[model samples]
Target chain A: MKDLALLEDNAPKPGLWTQIAHPGLFLGWSRHLIVPLAVITAALAAWGLYLSFWGSPPDYQMGDTVRIMYVHVPAAWLSQFCYAVMFASAIGTLVWRHPMADVSQKAAAPLGAAFTLLALFTGSLWGRPTWGTFWEWDGRMTSTLVLLFIYLGIIALWRAFDDQLKAARFVSVVTLVGAINIPVIKFSVDWWQTLHQPASVIRLDGPTIAPEILIPLLVMTAAFSMLFLTLHLVRMRTEVIKRRIRSLELAAARAAAGGAL
Target chain B: MRAFLAIVARDLRLGLRQGGDILTLVLFFVIVGTVLPFAIGPDRPQLARLAPAIVWVAALLAQLLSNERLFGSDFEDGSLAILRHAPLPLEMVVGAKMLAHWVLTALPIIAATPVLALMLGMEGETLLRAIGSLVLGTPALVAFGTVGAAVTVGLKRGGLVAPVLVLPLSLPVLIFGTGAMAPMVPGASGQALLLLAALGLVSVALVPFAAAMALRFAGE
Candidate 1:
């Protein structure tokens, strides 16, 4: 009775960090999220796609090529958005030392890279007809490409270390360094734009875009956001299982070694 | 103070002990410069126009050659482990190492850049501005590279990883560095110079802590 009471007394109340970061608890809740989230993402995506392709009118200046904006804008937004999540997760890993945060950071990299590449791809598609060139060395395009490279570098860093725990620390530093770097590069490239283009160049989408196009774009972005959330939660759950499997494998290997000894 | 100086001195002494290494970096820098003309065609005006950018890229690549070893030797010998526990903070040690790296690697390249630029047909103020940009920008390069070095120091195949990681971060420096080479307006390059210096100073100021954090956890 005394020992049980002592155990109860000693147990620390979970804080916000712990509540959010507990991998087992995360797996439980995230499992529930996966289905509903995927369903919503699909519905939103269909609606968004329908509105983008059929519902909205062709752009005045860009014609039908403007439809590519629906996919391109969201991918571009998610590219930065995913990095922001990774950056926060990195801070969480460093400060909180939580496996969930590490899982998020590890999971977000490839997704971020995919989004960045998509941004580059869809952007080039849009660029071809609009600019009469498949590639333009403008600040936005160049910076996005650089952002893609940064994402790849982070992914590479994650794979470089044999020990995942140690990798987390190194990755956190790199992520933070990258976060600091992104703005500086953005500024510098935009500044370069001033040098190369003394005259203002074409805007991808002019400010105050008509609501007909803007609503669908926003809906598609929300769909992308939902898709990213569903994927992120699912990835985090898989990472939890992967870690468990890794530990079990390590333990079995140790047991075998012990038996031989 | 003494401890900080000691790291810088130790690294400097060790770097100097390997004489071919410095020569190799300078050679690499020049070779990159020489190869560009062949690939891009040796139109004098075109070469002159591209000279500043060529120098900046070569300088960055040269810095990368030394980055893989920035902390590897010490980490291998376990001195890095001890240093983490030492009286001086790891940030100070990283800062010292960064300074030493800058001194050994970047300085020689900076010294040789004017010659490379001159050979590429950049003359007078353009050559001077290119060199000036190097003076301001290379520290930012080293500062960011130190973080890359510190991040990858634990990896077995860190060489390629450091460049991949460092190059994107170096984009701003490349832009502003080349910007300072030819001021569009008379005072324009000055603004580029100021931004480059800010990048260098800001990076130099903050990178130590980040490197130190990475070193600490990676060591554990």
Candidate 2:
């Protein structure tokens, strides 16, 4: 009943959206998160977009087409990274029973799925002119497709449950257990001879790409991270509101049942 | 030990009384394997080259189909509650159930692989490797499959959803199973069997308890 005060009092307020959506609380959830994130994202995007189109050197072999790496490589990184986030969140939620862990995990799923699709599409696009085929059943590509399926499966399992709590727990288990595939996706190229290039950015000797390319790739990575943050926050707020509405409806139903009795 | 064996025998008896559960899974494996060559064309060399991977994949898929049998009916009937409350730990009960499942589903796949290999024109050393890999790898299938089955046991339409949850975790088996047989294709046997054996050992040690916990959660 005490928790219901916010719902009972605020449900009729039209001006609540402006207050709830205030960027201050969004950014203030963690101290100084938004400012640094905004600065880094803007700087990187500007630098990367400039170099990708105008400044970065063309590969001696691939020419202008190599620019797509600025997009494709970062997307590939984020797809894997987002899944890791989902996986870690899932584990945290399950083991510690952190409520936000569930919220963040659910929020991360669609974001991860989107990144996976973009990675696949971009990889296919890059493959067309480079590999002379739109796709290869090579270890990396095949594993990426598998990763996408894992994402879809998690999301599907979550949506299938009527109770959000039950669904969250189910999806959490699936994500944590399926974390095995992340390493496979990351190291698939090295483990198996594949058309996809071996790790260039995070290798032991360090990134093989020049600063020009690396800068943009890092920029794109930041942009992708920020995009994930923005979207997840929005989605989590939506979930919290939806849960509020559901509880209110249940309360109303109980009250009506009591009145009839 | 009696508790363990009793559970195993009980599951085996249940599987038998159900009459066609084990046979249907084996039949599904053979039929799917046979149909694939037809669908893809009967190129003998190609089939021979793919025989190990194909047989393993078919076995894995068929293993997925049989997974629903692991805890589905028992969970629904509240027998699982009795098992959980029994003096025997839930882990041992799950372990016994998983072993029985291996004997029923995986053993058939392994037994039929030699025949399936012959049909695909796999010869001599390759055939041996294929069967050997299945023998080593199938336990992992049961281990992880039991985990997935436990996780989904209380949900509606759990049977359809279990494979999607299980398949990714089972990749080590698929990878090592196929990898182990790779050398036999070229007339040599290699680390695939070694890795397959390792995965089986690890899964046997770890998966049962994890699966038991998952079953406890689903039951809740």
The CA-based lDDT of model 1 is what? 0.88
- Runs of candidate 2 exceeding 4 Å displacement: A1-47, A184-206, B184-188
Q: Relative to the unseen true structure, what is the C-alpha lDDT of residue A158 in candidate 1, on a scale of 0 to 100?
A: 82
lDDT of 2 by residue, A1-261 (tens): 334564444435335553343322333353345556666667777877887888778877778878877777777788888888888888877787665677778888988889889889988887788777888555666678878888887776776667777667767766766775456434532343322243332111254767877776677777777767766666776776677677778778888898999
Query: Which digits, one per residue and each the tens of the lDDT, describe model 2 over residues B1-220?
Result: 9989998998888877876877788789998889889887889998888887789889999999888878888888889988877889998888889888888888877888877888989989878878888899899888778777877777786666778767766776787777777652332246557766877887788777667767777777
Off by over 4 Å in 1: A1-19, A204-207, B183-186
TM-score for each predicted model, relative to the true structure: 0.95, 0.86
Per-residue error at B4 for model 2, in Å? 2.3
TM-score, predicted candidate 1 vs. hidden true structure? 0.95
Candidate 1, B56-160: lDDT as tens digits: 888988887878888889988999998877789999999999999999999999999878988899988888888889989999999988999888887787878
Please give the distance, in angstroms, between residue B11's alpha carbon in candidate 2 and its true position after superposition.
Answer: 0.5
Candidate 1 lDDT over residue span A1-261, tens digit each: 333233224336666654556665566567778899999999999999999999999978878999999999999999999999999999989898877789999999999999999999999999898788889987898999999999999999888888887788889999999998899889998888888777565886559788998999999999999999989888888887887666667767887898999
